[model samples]
Target: MSYFDLSKFPPSSAASDDGSVSSLLSISPRSSRSIILDQSFFDAEDPSPSPRGLAEPPPQRSLPAINDALYSVQVNNRRRSTNSNTTTSVSSNYDSDSSGRSGRRPIKTGEMGTSSERESDGEVRYQEKKSKPKPKKKVSVVISGGDKVKRNGGIRMAPLNVPIKRRLQTAAVLLHGFTIPLYTSLFWFLLAIPLTWPILIPYLIYCLFSEAHFDGSAPRRRSHFLRSLPVWRLYTGYFPLKLHATTSLDPAKNYIFTYHPHGIISHGAFGHFCTENTTGFEGLFPGITNTLLTLDSNFRVPFYRDFLMFMGLASVSRRSCEALLRGEAAQPPPTWSAWKPWTWWRLVFLLPIFHPAPHYTAPTGGGRAITIVLGGARESLEAIPGRMALVVKRRRGVLRIAIRENAGIVPVLSFGENELYDQMVPTGGGMIEKLQMFVKSVAGFTVPLFHARGVFNYDVGLLPYRKEVNTVVGRPVFPKAQMESPRDGDLDEFQERYLAELRRLWDEHKDVYAKGRLPGKEGEMVFVG
Candidate 1:
């Protein structure tokens, strides 16, 4: 018999009572012998075997049997002591040991077999046991000023340290989004005459000199000159923007950066391009001169032309484009002119012949770059926060410009650019739409009925909401020279290729930076020249 055989029995305590008990009985059944167990048997209970019809013995029944076996051993010892008087005590002790050994052997064997059978049948029998629960600690609370008060049965509380920078940033964001726009509008309205006059004067001059000789430096610097005013900085203080660039851009390389989804006046573009201290423009792209292009009418004012140039702005005219592109290395000091006297007539007459040295020789050299809001003012009316909808319909002029100038095209996608202002209605055609289009065609920019947070209130005016702006610069697209105008078929193919590259750039990094914002759908490069 093997140890696993449950039917095998061990030696009985009754066998020790008679001399007739054989040596075989003393040896017990071979199946009852203990052996080193398999590790798997102890680790996991196998459930493949089915249980037999025999039910497990009740606890009460097993306990009485155990008690009886112990009682019998005591009774046999007592009888042995009486039978031999002097030697009886000694014999009784031996008999008691033999009985105890015999009884315990069967009990141990039975327990082992039962446990194994139950485990094989997947029936686990756990002895009922309960553990005492741990006592709760007493909590104590300290009260300020004169008394140390004990509370919550003496429980101790840990101190929490809040980060000061994170708290301040959150506060700044709330203030910009909720309180700045109202103050900005109020300030603008109060000083509208003074502000409007300065801008108005140069704007008229630019229009009068529309076909006149072009001098690049004066006009470009005047556009951003308003930033120098202490009052203007106060207005922008409510919504401060920080600019950072991943790589340095060479100024000598003429670049045409196409900005998308024209936000209401593109406050982001203005902040980044027009101001030096705010955007850190000089630090990021060292040696790369940038001009944020504006409509020709912007430089028409008398005082505004000088102001715009001071602000680093220039006209977005084709003539202005050629002049800047063909401009000299660095302007000669104003005093070192061949035709000195610096009169308006002399400056105007000498301008055409006084071509400044080329700012850029090779496309790869350090040169000036132009940033065009390609979506234009119509796109501004359609601008929705978190979604980019470019207005490329019939807008092949930019492509032509790229090819003509031999400039590399850099598509710029700005996330959260549109989140700044809430528009009058949803972005499509209607009576309002016709009016906006007419205004754009005549005035160069549409007046968007937009609103954002005020300086002292949560709503009202044309300021941008306090949302992070992430501007991604796509890889450059080099233009191929063509002797003649591109056919419709060739144009379509080129546009398709350009759009594909743009979409690829958006797809790759959009998830990394714009996880929460709505994603742009399959963009249609609608040509609406």
Candidate 2:
């Protein structure tokens, strides 16, 4: 998320592997020419003067000087001979300086001085300036384009010489990736401890019955402190997720963000929406309080459930969606007895079930947003390493919700999301695919058999491989007007426009962000039902 600024570091005190003195010098490119100067440039009096007493612009103010040895090192590295074109040519007003007039003039380029002219007092001053060692400063200059000295090609393991800070960053991401399993194990382990049952049982009851997720009020349990943790920066640096907003979103209007191709875990979605500091969600879309929507079943897990809620994630059900967009409270949880299972069956199923609603409420939209991964778990099955496909064609539910709520629909395309993991994708209508669909029908979510790099090793584990994920937020497509009962034609028209915008976003950024994408059809973005 942050670039390493070479300016902050001290100059190297030793020689580099290439047999060149690694000392940093104040070299800057001006007019496509590398201007290398010695101690004469920073002296009390300028040795070189401007022609005809006119002030020529100074070489763009250089970085702080470090070592005198770098002067020789830089000159040798360029491998250019001192001449009319390469060396620093000066225009001196030696006669004017001798007559007591100010001779301080700017540096210029031209022919070299005569041997007798070079041996003048100015030359003696230059010799004195070089002989006396100038104090080294604790500053450096960043190369114009990039300062990354060395890079290796192909897949390689983390080098042993990796910095401690980078290692800690990897650790932070590893901890986050195992959050669900870690919390699950911790929850069961706590249950085993009879002494902690007094605390754990009540917490378990609260996690199971709390209607906090459904109410759609500002999440009281959502810990801003936790979400703003420094660890999220490392998590982001793991894949180094970058968020791009194509157009500024209006805070007065509500938005429904449709995230595509739920890659493995939808890490892009979580980083961009769930946490503010990760992708600078707050700064990017100012005044908009966006809540990431996930499967309601996730709240069924014990400790892991609490973790999701704390991250400001809400249920992706009709009631929660409606409540959030309306900026109003949802219908209060209905009270029912355990003995009368028949009476409370609807209450249990209706509250969390993702049923499409035809009824529309009076628009009371504000600076609120609900981010839904359009592809969901079904599309996750198609998440291969280098391919980009989405189960998006049939998913018009978000559009309908946006129409009813009078909210803008923002299509988000995440490049390199599918490259995070390798999955065992079944052939079309194959037995494996059929079995996966059957499970999804029964449990509402299906798991894709996937694997990636390990903790310490770069092979065989659940940790998503280190890849760059760029999540681009396209312009919001607002409804023409609020409609109590939107027509099918209207919904289709909106969907068409939304899909077109999404495709355009892909085409605009695919080459830059998806260069690693597979060749031909496998790499092309496709829509499926």
Candidate 3:
């Protein structure tokens, strides 16, 4: 619709030769006439024509001023359209036009190109704006595979298609876990049978009065056959345990091997020391007879006691430890003649009947070594997966024994021992912990509420997860000579040196062995009394 009334506002006297009003308006301001419209035209869409005096020619301006004003008006109009719901003021546009005529406009994001581009077609340049591309942010990604997996919150169910050999390995460990119960049940079952009383009664009497367990010249019932069983290899394979000795132990010298972080079951110590098939302890340190020491109270159990002695395990009692160490200096155990070729069939049956008494078959000679779990029962309470805490700060009995015997103290640290079980440990000084402590004070051992994988499922059972356990034996710390009466100061000095060696051993191999440790402070090696 036409808003201007052309009838009243005729062409000005200074119009261009073409007689066009637009041509006159486009002239340089210096030679241009002022064009004013009626006030009514701006107030309404249709307005009455103004008086003829409004058509009179006005003052002129230069061409440069005219061009600058046009540019300023165009820029102002563009800004006004971009901003929503805003009124444009003609006075402000004229003020800006009058202020600048030579300076270039500042560049902005998503704006038109350079001044050269603006000098061409303003409409085309405004349409061809350079849109600044938004910067892309980087993201980190993690990948999971067969060996390791991101734990989704749910029960970890085991796959059905497991190999038969792996299943057998799991079964072997399962048997070991149930040894005490299984043997005790068997003993009671046999006792229930009245016909077996004659043999069983004598065995019970012998077990009760047997100095053979504590006197420790050499374990009479320590069966080399049982220690070197193929089942031990399968048990080791369940968690795929390994042993690494930093240096060879001398055959002529006695050594005290102290194990750290007494895990719930101490599976690493059992698999490494008590069994010959796991890491070939004998092959690693030949001529040294190592006896794994356990609590003396364990000897009270009937069948389990015999089973432990069969695996070359001894009591950790003062008498037993001293006896084993003293036996080393005395005569070695008696040896039997080599088996003749005719006994090949009996050997194939895997029986312990022969009592193959080789000179080095038992903990005999001066080359005897005793392995003690230095942390004992208290440390078992801290057996959380991917974490370790040793109760060795004030426990100096084993160290005192080492000093008195003039034995080398071998520091053994087994990584992943605590990863065998998931335990529900109560917070320190809590009611539950107080109750646990009370039980421990009376029973000599604290019961850890723990669990792990099952026979069929990967979660919710007693079987330990398929984790790798690496037991690294550090260099032995020994005094200059034996001290039958070591002073408190001397004991302190020796213990500091021993503790230093233990910390060094941990620092050296923690990265490789404890890669899967829990995060933050809980994952660290804590020492407690």
**Against the true structure, whose TM-score is highest?**
3
Query: TM-score, each model?
Result: 0.52, 0.63, 0.66
Q: Per-residue lDDT for 1-529 in model 2, tens only?
A: 1111222233333222233322212233221222222223233443333312333443333333333333443454344324435333222212123345433322222322443342231221111111356896534222112222222232234445556766777798788878888999988997899987766766666667766676775343366767778888888887888999998988888999999779888989988888867787888888787889998888888767767876778899888898888876333334456543323322433522122122322234478888999998888887886777888878877878888989999999998788888887777688888988899998888878898876654656888877888999998998877887889899889888888999999899889888888899878888877
lDDT of 1 by residue, 353-462 (tens): 23332342323343667778888887886675555667875677767666666666777777667776777764457788788789888998888878874333234544
- Candidate structures ordered by TM-score, highest first: 3, 2, 1
Candidate 1 stretches greater than 4 Å from native:
1-207, 210-215, 218-252, 328-366, 426-429, 482-494, 519-529
Relative to the true structure, candidate 2 reaches a TM of 0.63
What is residue 265's positional error in candidate 2, in angstroms? 0.7
1-529 in candidate 3: lDDT tens per residue? 1122333233332222333222123222332222222223233333333423244454334445544655665676567656755342222211111354321122242454553444343321112223468896533223211422223345554455667788799899999999989989999998999987866776677577666566775444467777777899999987888899888888888899999879888998898889885787878888887788998778889878767877878888998899888773244543433442223322333554335334444444468788999888889998887887888878888878988988999999999899878899888589889988898898788788899887866667998878888999999899866789888888888999999999998889989999988888888887867
lDDT at 40, model 1: 25
Report the lDDT of model 3 for residue 466: 81
What are the per-model C-alpha RMSD values against the true structure?
A: 21.0, 22.4, 15.6
Model 1 lowest lDDT segment of ten: 19-28
Q: lDDT at 249 for candidate 1? A: 59
Which is superior by lDDT, 2 or 3? Answer: 3
lDDT, residue 294, candidate 3: 91
